[model samples]
Target: MTSGTADSGRVRSGLRGAAWLLPAAIVLVALNFRGPIVAPAPVIGDIRADLGMTATVAGLLTTIPVLCFALATPFASWVIARFTAERAVSLSLVIVLVGTVVRSIPHEAALLIGTAVIGIGITIGNVVIPVVIRRDTSPERVGLVTGVYTSALNIGSMTTSLGTAPIAAAWGWPIAIAVWGVLALIAAAAWTYTVGAGAAWRGSDHDSEPLPVTGPIDQVLDTGSVRTATEQRAAVIETLPHPAKRWVTWGLMLAFGGQAFSYYALTAWIPTLLHDEIGFDTASSGASSSVFQILAVVGALGVPVLANRFRPRVIIVLVAFFWLAMPLGLLIAPQLWLLWSVLGGAAQGGGITIIFIVIVRLVSNDDDARRMSAFVQGGGYLLGSAGPLVAGALHGATGGWTAPLLTVLVAVLLLGVVGSVSARKVR
Candidate 1:
């Protein structure tokens, strides 16, 4: 056969191979995003004693990462634009690996600095994964893959939260927190292998541009026309409204902020709330909180199934109801903590999934996807990073769970209102 025919065969082979491997790689990477942040929480007292830090400083271990999620988003967007999504993922994993090792070094300064580095690394992953999902997955499968991706995030959080304190007991908190880096290293190697294999088959070195199905060979073979087409597309995008100016974008940002605020606040203090309000012991309270984290997987997976049958607005309303029920249920009937936790868990998980789905559906292309994801997540996390602190402060001031639960209820109300407005059909 001719050279053109041979090249086509190689491209097709690469596509088929990537179809399965890509999603697996995405899931693996997802598993690392939240695990590292939550790992230190279960062993915070040990960590504080070991490092000689006060409670406020120790709290930064988790807070720093959420702040980084907001602060580093613009930088994350730039990295994706500079390097391809595949290379960005590899770089993020490497950064996470290095940060994990640094945090395990048994020094207070190292622990704090290392936590910041991990946050920065995870920020990059947060921005890119959605872009990769939007670019690689077929239109029909985007919702399914997004759900799986979000669900994996919860699984990681649940795994680390439930497992860390025991591991710390056996081997020390440093080792307990550091062990998660192994997963990041494995994911990096797997992702790097896929990128290399695809590059070899496609026979290209430039990773700056998104290629059509046939790959970068087309650009190499027809540089002038490809450049013109790219320029034209950019010009068209320029003519449209900026992402910042769009009402839907702002609505989604608020929706995400409310979701993040509720999730982080609850994750940080649900055990304490249960102990104080429901009279559960320390161990029981901790175990009960796990119910909230683990049930998120169900919520994440359920959103896609609901999407198949209902309009986006209907799903948003339903999720909002669940979110509203959690705070109200906790305030009115603390006896049913289990039931409220399950509903709240599902609401948080489904809330994030639906926002992601709306983002991917609303954007016109990969560049738009990157920018929009960064904008929404950056704003959302900035608001979210305040959740735990605010909840703690309210509890301290009022000396009751009632005030904090009311605060959470207000945030959920914002979520329902803005989420409904955001989900309205775009004309």
Candidate 2:
């Protein structure tokens, strides 16, 4: 066989051999994304006491990361374009590893700066992983893989929430928070190995070309005429609506925004809300709130199955029902907090997965995937960063949980309305 044909064969063989590794690496990297962020929360008191930080400054530890996820997204998109997705993943892990270590340095400045760096790293991974999924996975498996990807995120959050306090008790908060760096390090090493293996087998260091489009764009491009790659891309671009004008794009953004807003708002206040409203002690409230975190694994894994069986609109309705039910249920019946938490957790988890599934299915190429993912996530996170503050303010102003719960209820309603509109089948 000619060298070109032999090289092509080797590339395919290498990809097939390493297919399993990609998913494994994705899960491991995802574990680092949320674990480091949440790790400090369980020991925030320890950190505050050790570093002599005021409550406002202590709050920045978590707030900085969410802000980074929002404001740094465009930069994350640029990183993916500049460095190939594989390389970006490696770079992100390196940054996360470095940030984790820095955050353990026992200085308040180091703590805040390290959290920001970790947020930036996680932001890069957030943008690029969707690009990687779109580029590497088969069309049919996109939902399943996206589900797994999101599920890992929740697993990481839940794991860190549960484990950090005990570790802090045993060693100290810094060690407890710093220990997650091992996860980032291992994921980075594994991803680098896969990248090297693929390069070695393919005899090429370039980013893999975008997978062939199979939708309307594909039909438009494949007119049995010779066209340069640029011409084909131009043709595809002509067929699609402008990103700003597309209803699906805007709808997905709103849907994601509502989801994120609700999630952060609840996460910030649920334990306190439970304590105040239901007469639950601190320990019981915390354990109850964990139901919200742990049940997300179910929601994440279930979205793909629902996607396979139902229309996107149907899935959105189901997710919206649960999301809406949680706040309303909380407002009407504080005693049933556990049930509301379960529903809300599943809804939040499923909400994110379904939005991702739609993005993967709707975008025409890897470039579109990266841009759209960044756009949706960036907008969503920007709104989400305010959720806790707004809820807290409303609660303090009213001297009751009613107003805060009602605000979340309204957000959930908006989520359902826009999400259903967005889920309309694309022609």
Candidate 3:
């Protein structure tokens, strides 16, 4: 054999090894996605008192990151596609690390800015995760990994939510936020090791031919500077076919987006709604909020078992019915409805899992999968940005949640519509 062919074979071998390391990186980053945002929720009061933030301002502080997801996603996608996924992951860790340090400061401005930075990092990682799992793992294992990965995201969020307050009490909020920097550093190290191993394997190969997945890596390198891979991923998605034309794509979008509307909206405004509308005390309202979050973690963890046995579409249909009932049931009966709220959050928690699964199954190829994933999340989150804010505004204008509740009620119905279609046996 020619030396060129031998070198090429060796590089391919190395690349395969690097690909295998992807899941661990994905799991770690998935768990870390909501850490920056959720960790501070439990300690907001202290931050408020210490930083002199008003309620409206604190609301902005939270919303700033959500808005970044909407705005930064396109750029983030472009980034992931341009630099090679592993390099993109590495870059995002730096973003997270920088953001964490910034938030560690006592100033409100710095904290909010840092939150936006972290959101940008997480946004890229979030959009790409399913694509990574779907393309990298064997198809038979997808359901299980999807479940664990989604669960990790919720657990990560829950971990921060539950642990952040105590952490703040011990080290102060600055240190609390800063501590996450260590997590980012660890993720970055693992990813670097994995990618380097892949490159080493390839570099040592005797052949000079490019790898199969070189398209995405070259696209990333071609589209953007080495620094902005997430931006590159976003750019690549805009140029692709509408994956929604496929049943799985649309179904996942509807189910997932509808679920996100409820999840993000309630998480944003639930405490206020309970406190203001239900006359619950501040502590009681916050506790109620935590219940929703904690239960979501449970739902996320539980989806894989169901998906493994039944057809994914069938499972989606059942999930859809349950989802439709949750919010509508709450609207119908508001008496001691904290349990209902928790139930709704728990059901909606599956939305993230469904989103991951659908993207993996919908597209026929890796490029399509990543593009579809970006489009769905990009569109879904843009819509999600409106959910809580619009609900708040509608309630403000109407003087009751009548309009807002009805809207979510309709959204619940539509979620089933989209999910049922997507869940249909993928063509």
Candidate 4:
């Protein structure tokens, strides 16, 4: 009787410890979410001027981080499975801190290397946050937590995008990059304090599964189950939602991919685009891009609220119809269309938020959601990663911006089709 009591007490204490670490780790990871990617965008020109580089190289710099996003997600599933979600996320933040510090070095080589590392950190955070939420929180609250997480991610992104440029303008670019490290370190400290030294706690009502961390080697050798191993590998590549889900997944991916491509191009080069095309100064461009991002947050916030009140598909279709005009407006009416661009971005972000919210609710279990998340993002970002670079490359290759603009026009139309498909009522 005493032995059993002691074991129960130890288990109870462990769960208590995990409860604190779990949420703290989540919020900390969320803090670093957009720090690596968008924060550096505003400083692109500074780096270019310093290095005497071309626009193509600039595109490569942004492309590298996104490519990491595409690549890192597959590894994330393995990461959470092996180390567990909290540990995987905690370790990713460490990478973010280290990456930020490294980028702060005055050398161009380190900047590239550090940026990629920071992206790797963000990638893990992106993939695991959903899984952790499903595992730890109650079913009813999943949608709410998804919104909160999305909000946290956007908040981090907006801060980084807005903060980095001004800092780089005042201090050296290295200092600007390094400044974000403080947040990462603070996140790490908060996480460690909350969880103490061990993994997150498991409650009695929970069916405690292993966290989502596993490397390829672990998959091939450690698991030793050919069936589960094959499924894991496939999970990263294809989402393969059922008949009802098929169009929805493709539509979300396309709509997401389309706007994402455009947004990346716009945010990365809006200042340059306006400067080269119209005559706006850098400050004006930055302010405009910041406004666009802020509106995106508004759209993201509207997703759950609107979702609860309306059919998810109807909301999606409305957003899609609105988004169709963004690229067209940019091409035909630069003066009138910049506002359209901003509104389009917000619509896309909102659509994405609801897509994820539905995903949070629709899947049957935590593991399924994790697999679905990895597959959707992996494939989605594969398309998404290509958009910005292609736009930049088109401008470089053709010696004109018109081709890039035209490409966005085509992409915008296609994305609408996808969004329409994604708006279906199937679970």
Candidate 5:
């Protein structure tokens, strides 16, 4: 072949290689999001004893980051509009790295501050990663991309839950927790090169243009072209309807909120619940949580497949029942920890996946997805953050596990009610 043909072949090869990197970067960044939050749980007892922290303050360790997720959602969209998904995610990873290191300082104040910083980073990644998937992946591959990223989240949580205690026993909890920062650093570096450079390769089209950050959901509704705020709102209201006016969307948002609240509450306290209430040792408690997260990975991957076969709402209702079984089993028969963990993990993994899938399908296009996601996640996380705090305080005041388990049950019931409405077939 001639020289030009050889050069063309090299370019094609390069593009093919680059294609793999984007998904890898997405999965890697996703992996970093949950591990930091989950890491402290396995060793939470040690932290509390060492720091002389009460149950309520220890619960704040988990609550602070979740609250950040709530506060960071809208701002994530604005940051993406200003900096693009690539840069936003890169900066997020950096923040996570710094937070992880700072939290390792082994002081009460540093721990809280660092955890909050990591939460901010994770929240930004949570908002932008989906947008990046939509923009970068082909229409046919979107489902696969979504599944991959979601699975990575569970994998991160599982790894941290299972491994932290062992590592802590060997070295110390501080070292075990802080080591995750290295993963964050690696993800940040890869994202800076792959996502940033890849965005440049895709050219300066509408996808490259900065979205109008301020407005009444105008630009978010129209992906075709920029329009005046009024024109965009009229067009969106005509086609999609505002989140406030759409009862179904609100239902979906509440469903999302309920699931989030339940998941965070369980994760924050499951180890303690197993150890304190049921008389399991620390290692056993951590292993139980590991089981919960392991099954979560299965649920995340499996739910989307079932969704293709079943009505999304039916699947969601079934998932809600599984979630209910978690606290109910704990209340009625504490020995069935294994069964409850499996059920809860599967419910959480599948439920979260289904909720996001519903959000994406509810919208007409990518722009609509961004707006709906922002509203749902921003509001849902704020609602969810309260779960851990309230549960901890209840446990502190009551001196028993009854109230906290009841709280989990209530959240599950609310999730089912709203999820049913959101899952109804749209005409």
Candidate 6:
């Protein structure tokens, strides 16, 4: 074989190897994103009692992260511009580590401060990772990679939520909370290596041809480094016209908000629902809640594969059914709460994956996907932040679960309508 061909082949092989490492690193980062947030929820009772915190104050521990996710996602691209995606994510891990250690100090002030810091770190990771995946992976593999990413997120959440109670019982809640920091540190290390290797690969393959830009969004992704992020945004805006006007973007946002609304509402109240409404004991209630998170991993892994193969609308309908079934089942058949929990978890995981795939498909290029993802997540999550509070209010006003379950049913119906629109083909 000719030396030129051989050199070209080696470069291709090196790029392929680096691509594999990138996904692994991405998965590790995904795992840490939710584990830290999930850990505190399972040990919240202990935290509240030990710290002498009011229920209102303790609720902020969970609410702060969701709030940050909504508020911080818009500006995530700015961070990506400042440090690059890799460095920003690695810096986020450092923030997470610091937060974990501070919260473990066994002080009320430290716990609140640390949790908010970790939330900020998680918010950046959440917004930037989709853009990273889109830029890094081949088009056909985006769905699969998203599936794995979502699955890793659910797995981390499940691990901490289930393990935290047991670990805290054996050691202490502070230690249980701090243990996840070790995983964050490990993720940061993997990301650092991935960034260094990716840079080297880019330098070596400088002669390789760039991916063809099919549209405005593709043009945005192509700006890997053309001066500042401000310039990048200005360029994207100039080319793309009106991103917000697209019906699909709005549909995607509503669907995204619907899923977030249901997930957060249930996450905040499911254990209590199991205990008070379903007649489960304290331990059983927590265990049942953990099962919901565990089963969600199954949906996260399976749904994307199905969405890729079958009609996207069919999957949306299926997700809507899951959403509808959960609240109806809880309301009508309290005896089978376990089944409802599984359905709810599956619906949440699968629904999230479906929305992500929709976002990826909605835009053909990395830039649009990044901006679209930012808007969908940023605006959607901001709208969704009210779900838990609204549900709580409904429950209080009625002094029962009926009003809350009905409220979830209305949200689920909206998900079906908006999600169906999002599943349609767009130019």
On lDDT, the candidate that comes out on top is 1
CA lDDT of each prediction against the hidden true structure: 0.81, 0.80, 0.67, 0.67, 0.80, 0.76
lDDT of 6 by residue, 313-365 (tens): 77888888987888999899988888887888888788888888777776755
TM-scores for every candidate against the unseen true structure: 0.88, 0.87, 0.77, 0.79, 0.86, 0.87
lDDT of 2 by residue, 223-253 (tens): 4555665676678777766666776788888
Cα lDDT of model 3 by residue, 69-123, tens digit: 7678789879876766666667777888888889888998898888888878877
lDDT for each residue of candidate 1 in 259-368, tens digit (9 for 90 to 100): 88888888877766877787766446556777888888888989988887787777888998998888899899989988998999888889999999989888876778
As a TM-score, model 6 comes out at 0.87
Which prediction has more favorable TM-score, 1 or 4? 1
List model 5 lDDT by residue over 22-133, tens digit each. 7787778988988898899889899998999888888888888889988988788788767756678888999999999999999999999999999998988888777766
Candidate 1 Cα misplacement greater than 4 A, ranges: 1-17, 200-233, 278-285
**Candidate with best TM-score:** 1
Pairs with backbone N, CA or C atoms under 3 Å apart (clashes), candidate 1: none
Give the Å shift of residue 389 in candidate 6.
2.6
Regions more than 4 Å wrong, model 3: 1-21, 48-56, 169-172, 197-254, 273-288, 324-342, 394-407, 425-427
Ranking by TM-score: 1, 6, 2, 5, 4, 3
In TM-score terms, candidate 2 sits at 0.87
Show how many residue pairs clash in every candidate, following the order shown.
0, 0, 30, 15, 0, 0
Whole-model lDDT for model 3 versus the true structure?
0.67
Model 2 global lDDT (CA atoms, 0 to 1): 0.80
lDDT of 4 by residue, 50-106 (tens): 877677766766677677777888787788777766688788899888888887776
The Cα error of candidate 6 at residue 415, in Å, is: 1.7
